[model samples]
Target: MNHGSQPEPPLDTPFGDWLRWALVRNGYDPEERGVQRRFADASGIPVATVSRLLRDKGQPDVGTCYALGVTLGIPVMPLLVRAGHLPPEALEKEPQPTERPRTPTTEEEALTALGVIDETDRAAVKSVINALTAKHRQEGTS
Candidate 1:
């Protein structure tokens, strides 16, 4: 992995161990250079929480796992599934249809066609569209 990139953790690896592995993959040594503290700062996670997470001390909440996934540049679902926040089925790739697909037309439909997999990410896309639409309205551009 590159200096800023994280490796995908093995499926059998414990979540806490994977968290530490992510630090190493990103070129940060949690023990030597206060990587957890830096991660806390970068991720807005508390130091104590990061410490406990590293030590596998407690079950992390969904939001915490989501934040960690965002910070680590990894898909949040796998972590969420591992943490029991989401079901394994949620991560399964849907089968492609054998027939023709419906095409989207309107802006909203087109946005929906982007195929955002996560509800949070989908909401974020909608929020951005709403904000941009409002700005366009203010500027008399749309």
Candidate 2:
């Protein structure tokens, strides 16, 4: 059976950049989370494969493309396009409106703000927060 058309990128375009954008937009920071390693873990693809892909070493097969899309919460078609799997006509149509990304929760904001501090201090703060949270849970309070 024929797989659907895959969008093709020009030889000059760095498809890995597309993947990076998708990952960042979805809150998977390579810098913070060991990008390739975490993505490999999440997508069940090999770390070497992800590394090669990031390095623009090869094109992913349909299944790999799908895995990356699912992991990053991005539309697979654009990824397919970047992978040169579809015809140019596929992207000629109008784009769909996507939901706005959810705002970070107060806790997320606080933790992110804390992330700017020294790593040891941040760890200590996180430990304190965890202990307080556990105590609150024990007391049956929100």
RMSD per candidate (Å) reads 11.7, 18.0
- TM-score between candidate 2 and the true structure: 0.52
| TM-score of model 1 vs. true structure | 0.58
* Candidate 1 lDDT by residue in tens digits, 35-63: 78888999899989999988988757988
| lDDT, candidate 2, at 15 | 74
Candidate 1: which pairs clash? none
Query: Taking the tens digit of each residue's C-alpha lDDT, what string does model 2 give over 1-142?
Result: 1112334335337877655555666666655658678779889989898888877898888889899878877668766777888865677763556655445677656667546456677678878989999999999995
Alpha-carbon error at 29 in model 2, in Å?
2.2
- The window of 10 residues in a row where model 1 has the poorest summed lDDT is 1-10
Per-residue lDDT for 109 in model 1?
72
The top-ranked prediction according to lDDT is 1
